[model samples]
Target: MSHQLSDISHQTSDTRYQPSGVRNDAAPIGVFDSGYGGLTVLKELVKVLPQYDYLYLGDNGRAPYGNRSFETVYEYTLQCVQWFFEQGCSLVILACNTASAKALRSIQQNDLPRIAPDKRVLGVIRPTTEVIGEYSENGEIGILATKGTVNSGSYPIEIHKFFPEARVYQEACPMWVPIVENNEIDTPGADFFIKKNLHALFHKGPKVDAVLLACTHYPLLKDKIQEHLPIDVKLVSQGELVANSLADYLRRHPEMEQRCSKNGRQQFFTTDATEDFDNHGTLFFGAPVSSTHIVL
Candidate 1:
């Protein structure tokens, strides 16, 4: 299911943009995902912070990090983080839910201090959880994610930490990512799997007031998901929510904000062949992007 690009070097970028108002903060913010899904997160980020530079790295070659062991995901994520740091990123966000659930803490705790002491690595789960409490009026939320994320129990744990009255229920949609990645988003094939997962989640819990699209890839299935969900249940996606959370994080930590370069430029990198990444990436990002081939 994979192929190689002979001219991967053509995908890399040049860093000679004119300084906006530089004092020494010209590094781009790093966004890493297991694959193209994180572009949804980055798209929202561009809307909120169109002034800052961003570099996105998708490990498409070893994607669906959801099915891999925690140790494997941790090692892969660590390699990507180090690559971003080497590319001059002061702050890196692990935009994949599985990576965040299984690898983020270990990276922050063990890798950051030893590798890039001044850099920071954040995750989508924390940002998504920070505001979900406000969306749960019935004190019940359902999470639709990959098996790895569900097994990690990050959503339930973090949600309780923020809203104890709110209950969390989750259903692992292992097939959803493959469906979306294969460009079957709006097909009947996708609809069948989407409805089946939503039904499982609802049947497993009390009438949930809101359903959290726990994986970034799940957002592509949002419309189909809503079509099958009860009228009373609201579907929450992580893109805008995560964007707002990141904006707030930067505001609260001016030190980090000041360190981010604000030139409104974006660069993309992938562990897969450039041609394949570009073809699929445009579908996720809503625009055609020429990506550099990179290895971690």
Candidate 2:
């Protein structure tokens, strides 16, 4: 169920240029997600990179990519990324786990350079795993994510590459996002699923010192998850760590960092109508979105 790429270092920049899907000259860093899950990552970005402009696209109409076919997810993600590029975004973030699993590399390899030379397309996976490697005391960690992310085995693979001795256990709470999306965080069923999954992770016998909320949507349920977990263990949210990672990356690559602006713009778009995306996204974004529906 997993495709392993041994030596991803070799997967780095290949000289051969191919046609990129789109191009643009916008000031915003475009962010795409299947739904509101990306807001967690975006919130962190705004906190860390407050002076920079941003453009967010949430694909709410065709959300919950976790249960969809891989090919479908890839195509849908590609469409959004292309749309962002057309909007003049220089960099894009694949903030959804399913998209990162199914489409990130193809965009990086076959699509990005052609679209915009050396332009960046960041993902939530590697930055998260890198943070996990940094904080894991005994090298035992747990990952709570969607079924697609768990199936991808991205956390384990990335962790093992850096910390071979680390023991990683993952639990796919397929219903968690729906519960969170529906604002059922306090519902009995929500608590039941949270308890059930936490117990399952406990039974895995990993002595988990840190738990990574691999899916960005998981941050919406952070309080509930923390309440269910033993206090000794720490919970890592993708948004927080990803924000720090992005700051570091910007420091290292000055060209990619946005120049200081007196007034930065934050643009939002959705493949679905603004009404649909706004209704659901506000909960995660902590504010109403000013999204325009695009033909992606």
Q: Note the Cα lDDT for every prediction shown.
A: 0.84, 0.76
Q: Distance from true position, residue 227, model 1, in Å?
A: 0.4
* Candidate number with greatest TM-score: 1
The sequence of per-residue lDDT tens digits that candidate 1 reaches over residues 159-225 is: 9898888889999999999998888987889988988888899888968989999998888888889
State the RMSD for candidate 1: 5.7
Which sections of candidate 1 miss by over 4 Å?
A: 1-22
Q: TM-scores across all candidates? A: 0.91, 0.87
Clashing pairs in 2: 25-88, 26-88
lDDT of 2 by residue, 1-296 (tens): 11111122321222111122112332567788998889878878877766456788888878879878778888889888878777666678888888987788888898877877757788888888776966778888998988988888778998888788989999999989889887899999999999999999989944898998888888888999999998989898988788888777766655555322212356677777788677776778776666778776
Residue-pair clashes per prediction, in order, are: 1, 2
